[model samples]
Target chain A: MRSGYYKETIVEHINLTDSTLQRAWIGIGLLLVIAAPFHFEFYGLSLITLMMITAIGAMGLNVLTGWTGLISLGQTAFMVLGAYAYAISTESWGWPPLLGFVLAGIVPAIASVIVGVPSLRLTGLYLAITTLASAFIVNHLVLEFDGLTNGSSGIFVNRPVIFGYAFDTDAKFYYLTAGFGILTILACLNLRRSRIGRALIAIRDNDNAARVMGIDLRAYKLYAFVASSFIVGISGALYGIFLSFVTVDGFPFLLAIEALAILIVGGMGSIAGAILGAVFLVGLPEVTSFVFSWMGSSAQSLLSTSAHEIKGLLYGLIIILFLRLQPHGLMGLWQDARRTWTLWPLKY
Target chain B: MNYLAELLASGLAVGAVYGLIAMSFAIIYKSTGLLNFAQGEMGMIIAYVAWSISTSVDGNPFIVALGSIGFAVLFALAVERIVIRPMMSEPILSQIMVTIGLSVIFRSAIILIWDGLPHNMAIASGNQLVDLGGVRVRAAQIAVLVALFAAIAGMWAFFRYSRFGVAMRAVASDDATAQLMGVSSGKVQMAAWAAAAVLSGVAGVLFAIAYELSPSLYALGLKAFPATILGGLDAVIGSAVGGLIIGVTENLVGGYISSGLKEVAGFVIIILILMVRPYGLFGEKRIERL
Candidate 1:
């Protein structure tokens, strides 16, 4: 029993060290940011932008799944809501682009309330199926609501204009998206430290125990839904505006799964995991495709022919490989590296 | 009146297919605690492969369908061996994600080959029709009903009479106890997957005939999900029965009420059924750990 208490103290000490590691990571991130612009080509800049968008979405889903333990298969639904909200509000309604971006998040937040109210009763796979239905509903609505969504022809989004500045180039969006990425990471960190986050973690680890602790499971679960949907919405708006179009063709249920995979591979329950996840899961494919493009005709043609088909297969393989061999994901791998480096002379 | 019967008949045909899809879901859940999200996609892949083989060499439709069924059995074994085996003790969410990833791979591969075009093709059966009372039922729909009936019988026999089937029942009730009895629970889980794949393959081909073979057919994943929820996730028979009910009610609602609200009706019933009986109509109430 004394040993158990000692173990708990060590665990707490390790958690404190993990926070310090995060600060070190931030230092590394700033250094990378400083070096990146000077060294980046078009593909490099685009890769960073893609990673930022992916990190934002994965972080949003991390709250829902990693923290709240609501296994959703439909974060893409919120994303679709955000994208369309951005497209229609900015391009169609003549609303200010900035406000449209904000609305992108607001719309999904409202929609999550509607969906989550019915859905909060469901646990585990039932909850997943509920969200799956929502994803289908959203997909069908987007396609059929052509009168508003422009049907399957797609919605064209205008470039982001804040005050008078327009972010049209990859480099420009990279900076903006990266800024948003930093803010989002900060928000997620703050949320993690907040009371609501603690309640959520309690519910995730044990719903009944949390309920016994005077934590309202329903309220916290809905909070997860809202928070997840809001972040997914913002990411969607960023994606749509950055691309200057919104299409149902791209935002399928797969996006939700892919985001989850990224979250898992990066670390199911960490901010640094979110970063490593977005970079590895989302950035890996882009880098792979870019490499293919550079290999000239044969490789380019092969990638063009099969790239879409291979992405999911590769992501699945990565997640499964990591889970079986390294369940702690990238963070676990990082820990192993640190331990080895710190113990270099002993060779332990 | 004829039109109404025809629609009812088609609804029954389609609903049976949905029932089969739901049954595939139910069977896997009964044996292993997994909600295999790839079940529908598995069906789609088998259907496409069968269609490809049949149309490619102009092979006898019978031979092609049989080949496809055989392939699906092997496919299930391979999937279980690779994806499901390693993650036996993995979290429920991760197990489900493996299926989700497989679903995407299946959908995209179908597209890469089929190029997203809808295919309207006859199955092993021709365009024969029979008049039942005043209703004209298509031959393919009849085939679907027959396939579903045969599937139900096959499952019943395997579960009730056969030793392996009985062992599967034991495993389904509790894998550890079954393992204690020396009935290799892993083998039972693999067999259950094989059975699900066969059901999915048959349902896929028939449903492909009922609705044209479109790449968008993967979207039908959720069409069976509501049925599974209504029937009870672990109740195999419940899947079939719930599917028929959902099918008839949906078509009737679409016929009587606004068609736009058809999905809403299906979902509402699902909610009601789930709330009223989470174990579903035929499912045994499971004891949850506190």
Candidate 2:
């Protein structure tokens, strides 16, 4: 149990030597992820795929709000930009699928720098409000530019084809999203140990102190915004492909709030928390529907009509309850349980 | 000329509503050092309460408005005690998230209860146009202007003369010093929330009178952000002026530019202002210490 506990050197510490049990658990988890589509039905597979897509976005948000201490209410706007970027480049301009995907991430990164330049000067709630305003502005622009975006009617997106293969089926798309999700997780994990990530954490902790320590506050913040928006934009592109349609309505303001909720509920500043939160929150509606089915026909009917509102209420309640009772979120609870289990025979 | 005059008059009326909401935002920020995102929702829920009262019992505007404002005070007090007070020790980010959570809960609850449909109150002379020379305005617009003036005077007098209000201002400036001076920061915070609720309640009720009460009314609360930002987050009077500026700009944009641009005009102005003056026009420049 303590094999990896004591590290002698900085390299060993940075390398994160996993114990045998930890490695086995990770291997099993990876296996399950790869085998999920084969075991689950179409509906279940699609739901999991959706959760993975949401996890990608949540990870992006965690980079900004959780790690950097910057609050953005315009995450959905970046997602919209990415979705539209991908859709237009691929469908309108006849660009290749791979290049279009890359542009999806790049577009939102550029937009983030545009918004970040003016608004990053202000911190806390002011930054939040600015982000919120940016979301509205982005949505309005999408609606106004009917020629490019097709207005409220929306545009259809073809399933992404790379090289010679097309990811058209739900099962195939699930693997595509999973591959990206794992890459995002690995990227975030690497970022946490990198110099840039340390600078961002420093800025988040105290910008003035960070500046005193010779960290460029503006530059690091812009980097955080760029990294966060870039990942979120990719997630948005995946979301567009998942729906096979791109519309402003798909990227509502509530979705931004949902991303924030994921960070809070899963555990802020924890990479594992992002994935856990995404699955829990994304799967919550389905869980509620199943319970509603057991209740009776009346409950099921209510679920169909007021599901969105009910889900919103639950999300709100969960956020408040978690903040009040479990500030560290589900990840905190998991860690505590693991510690207890690991030290079963010892008091300490 | 008449068309422009009519637009300006309407803009002033709507701006007054924004000012009232902005004042509500400023009060909370001033005293608690926390931004209440749910400020607009508080007014919205109260306005819905007013609508229900007018529909079920009596259509008397006075009774409806007074009852709702009374309810608003209790609601705000409860929220402070239940949600805000417990969160005093948390990080500012957690507190902000709490308010955002509160907003979502309030909005969703409103939808669950009222079913997301817009409701019209039978109290105000809603559509009746009162002509002032070359300009014509709705009676509700006149009521809105009256309410804004009344609110501003009431806030001024309270801050000037009232003991609690003075304590709130003290706490806003410096809490530890005020605490040493025997003014309970908790009570001041509670009072701030309650005072903000009153301002928002009046604004919401007036808004319902001029327009209609709906779940989306919370968006109007969001619009007040630009006002608060423009006026400076901590300046009550500044927010009011900012509200007027945003209202007129939005109106002119709608009248001249595409109607779509009207909704985002205030936001665009706020971005411009933040670029030039992060502290806002009338806001006190805050000096931070390491």
True contacts kept of each: 0.24, 0.59
Clash count for each candidate, listed in order shown: 1, 0
lDDT of 1 by residue, A36-105 (tens): 7678998777777888898999999999998988888888989999999989998889998889978998
Chain A TM-score per model, please list them: 0.88, 0.96
Tell me each candidate's TM-score.
0.89, 0.97
- Residues B1-290 of candidate 1: C-alpha lDDT, one tens digit per residue: 87778778877887888889889999999998888888888999988888888787574777877799889999999999987888879877777777776777777778766767888767545446778898977777888888888878888888889999899789888788889999998888889899899888888887777667887777556678778878888889888888887787888878887676676566666656655666678878872322
DockQ values, each candidate: 0.40, 0.61
CA deviation > 4 Å runs, candidate 2: A1-4, A344-347, B124-126, B287-290
TM-score of 2: 0.97
Candidate 1 deviant stretches above 4 angstroms? A1-28, A34-43, A142-148, A164-170, A290-296, A344-348, B52-62, B111-124, B129-136, B253-276, B287-290
| Per-residue accuracy of model 2 over A50-168 as CA lDDT, tens digit each | 99999999999999998899999999999999999999999999899899989999999999999998876788877888888889999999999999989999989999888979988
Root-mean-square deviation (CA) per prediction: 3.8, 1.7
